[model samples]
Target: MRAIFPIVTVVIVAIIGVIVFHLLSFPMPWMLGSLFGVLLTQLIWKIPMKWPVMMRNIGLLIVGTAIGQLFTFNILIAMKDTLLFMFMLNIVLSLFCLAMAYLLKKWARIPFATAIIASIPGGLSQLVVFAEEQKDIDVTVVTFFHVIRVLFVVGLIPIIVSLTGEVPGAPAQGSSNLLHNLSLILLGLLLLPIGKKLRLPVPHFLTPVLIGLLLSLFKVDVDPMDGHLLHIAQLCIGAYIGLLLHPKSLRLPVRVLIGGISSAILLLVLTFFIAEGMVFFFDLDFATSYLSTAPGGMDQMGLIATALQADATHVTIFQLFRMLFIYVIILPILKWKILK
Candidate 1:
């Protein structure tokens, strides 16, 4: 009974969010709607909500497969051309993180370790886990900063895209072959454990994505997912993220919130400049460049690219590259310098 009430309430909130977003004709209505709906419900009612991890993993699998359908030999070749630019951008973003940390330490009176951890543009889960190992850093503050930054970017970027007058085409109507769809599903399921064994980040999603990309390059005729299935996936992702918002986690002073917001805005501005550089140098489209440079998580940014009808292949390549670089190169340096 306890679980049932929270589940029912969350469902009701999700339904209302979907309806409202649909009425407003918003892009990626299911995702944004459910996110906002559950966030508001949790904040106002203080109700305890839970989103099953299994549901979120299923959503990741679907999204990863959909993105993989965009991959091709040509896309791979194009990504190779931008490798230098991606590496340069990583350096620039790292410097920016250090600058932001300095400002937070000076203005907000936060500890240097906490400021630096909060300022890093890595994945939220990665940052939180890293914070757990540090003695003086505040995990709640880092989480609060990341959650707010994600909300800001996700909400604002879609509106910016809409104003640019590039309406995405209708979702592809996939093949009606039940057998083919089942085969694809089976392939994704089989890859999940393999991805885990390989220790891939976000294995449920990345594993399917890697498999789908291989199939796409080989000209395999896997059908695209139906629009309804995609929406369900979005709903699961949005609800899961929404349930993570614990208002009590944000117990910092007003000045700390202000500082975090300011730092987030500064990061967005820097992202805009970097994206413009990519467009100017690489001759890429605006949406793809912006999405590639955005500091949001892999899945969230990928979804935004899909929503905006940008080159999902390019966006995915850049985002995955940056994520891997942060985890591999930048994080180790930070651990050595800051922890020692």
Candidate 2:
């Protein structure tokens, strides 16, 4: 009976999503669905059943794969601008962290690497993986801080949208061109085992970047077109996040918590102004610049673009570029110089 409850919950949420689709004229209200799921899980059963976790993971894998497939060759042309933005964004984000880290180390008395890990944008899984790799840092501390950052970003974004007088595509639902989406998903899954065999450096979804670049070599494009699939994917990821809530686990000292929140929000606002200036200087669009500096994951930023119906291409370009910077430059530098 307990096992069945989560299954029942998912069915109910899906039904609600469908109903929302029709009533809202196709907007899925992801934030509402997510909050409802989280609140329901907490209230109905503060201790989540295995079924809920399983369902949530399925949603994560599916949505994450689909979102990853959106990468393509045009990213190359935009690479120059993105790289420049990375250099600039990196300096700002790092400095913001550096100052915050000093404060955290002084008051919180945590190590520099732990503080830096906490300051990282999204990429929680990678942070965990790296935490494991680092000999000295407390994985628990890094995880705690990263979790705080995610909560802050997710919470703040909706508020920002509300202030802008746009509800986002909250109840978004529409035809997602998913003809080849399954194939891409399958391919992403396939890469995991193969990568395990081949010892690839990153997660399976990352291979699509290499795959995209290689496909570009042959002038072959495979950016999947199913927007509906993307929505479902986002739903899954969002659900997984919702399941992660536990007010009990957030027992941080008030000073550190306040400092972390202040640093992130301050950096977010400052980066927004800087990004806007950079966009104007580079003749880029407003929506694109706004998203690129929006503080958090690439997929989340892209979702913002979709919800607002903004310039997705530019957002994707810079977000991906910035992420690549994190992967290749920032991660390695921090790992080598600081974490190591």
Highest TM-score against the true fold, candidate: 1
Candidate 2 local lDDT, 196-252, one digit each (tens): 576533444345444545555777645543666655655655555554545654576
List residue ranges in candidate 2 displaced over 4 A. Answer: 1-28, 35-72, 158-162, 165-178, 192-204, 208-224, 311-313, 331-340
Q: With candidate 2 superimposed using the best TM-score fit, by how many Å does residue 115's alpha carbon deviate from the native?
A: 1.7
Query: Alpha carbon lDDT of residue 224, candidate 1?
Result: 71
Q: Candidate 1: where is the Cα deviation over 4 Å? A: 167-179
How many clashes show up per model?
0, 13
> Which residue pairs come into collision in candidate 1?
none
**Residue 45 lDDT in candidate 2:** 63
How big is the positional error of residue 104 in model 2, measured in Å on the Cα after superposition? 1.7
Residue 76 lDDT in candidate 1:
82
Q: Judged by lDDT, which candidate is best?
A: 1
For residues 99-151, write the lDDT of model 1, one tens digit per residue.
88998999898888899889888787778898888888888889888887887
TM-score per prediction, in order, is 0.93, 0.75
